[model samples]
Target: MRATVNQGPVDIDCRPTLPNITVMLYKDGQQIIPDFDKILPIQKKGFLLNDVSFEDSGIYYCQANNYTRTIILTVQDDSTYLSEPEIQIPSNTHFVLGSPFSLLCMLNISKNMSQSNTKLEWVLPPSAEV
Candidate 1:
């Protein structure tokens, strides 16, 4: 049966047969699950759409014919689209001694800087003035 929730589009579903039925959900097999979040009890052989969460991701079991059946539920992460920022230089990348070298330093930015053409200056160490 379609497990619609919050009147929103259904992401997952659950189906249990008769002979072992109840409004509340039960963990099948000998494995005892302490908490069953997001899943509402099945009262009168019907489940509504107001149940589910991202953390409720796992295998669920239902008892039938003195045996247990399994159903896997999963939620995808929205943060997967975010990419890592490009590094200007390796953390261990060091300069050689006695050689005048310039490294284009990157400014610490919280947002994307790719859209702007702004130039960044390398923050150099303090020079010794005598």
Candidate 2:
């Protein structure tokens, strides 16, 4: 089976006897598969995939013993035209006076999602007058 992770060395988490396999990771036409130090499949059954991220998005597949399974990952940008973040502004929030401030920009591909996919943006206060 195919697997993926955030931008980093390619990692695998499968069985030791799963027959040392090689997988590929990609992003915007670039490949980021690590040469060594990949996570081996847990020696036990029922493995869980933790910590999913944007750069970790892509397609994965494995062909072993003449059999195959595929995994697909879709990484949505924070500013998708197909959904919210459609308007670039905060919703009824407070701002401090005479202090530097910022907005947390979250481009929601869906209305039901939040935080995990957002990035922070900083805004500086106007300079003090003489």
Best by lDDT: 2
Writing each residue's lDDT as its tens digit, candidate 2 over 9-96 gives 3433322335454433333455444333332233332123344456456665433444444556554544432444433447776766
Residue by residue across 62-89, what tens digits does model 1's lDDT show? 5545544455645443322233334476
The models' CA-based lDDT, in order, is 0.42, 0.44
Q: In model 2, what is the error at residue 13, expressed in angstroms? A: 10
The TM-score, computed over Cα atoms with residue i paired to residue i, of candidate 1 is: 0.34
Which stretches of model 1 miss by more than 4 angstroms? Answer: 1-16, 23-37, 43-51, 81-130
lDDT of 2 at 114: 56
Name model 2 segments beyond 4 Å from true: 1-40, 44-50, 76-130
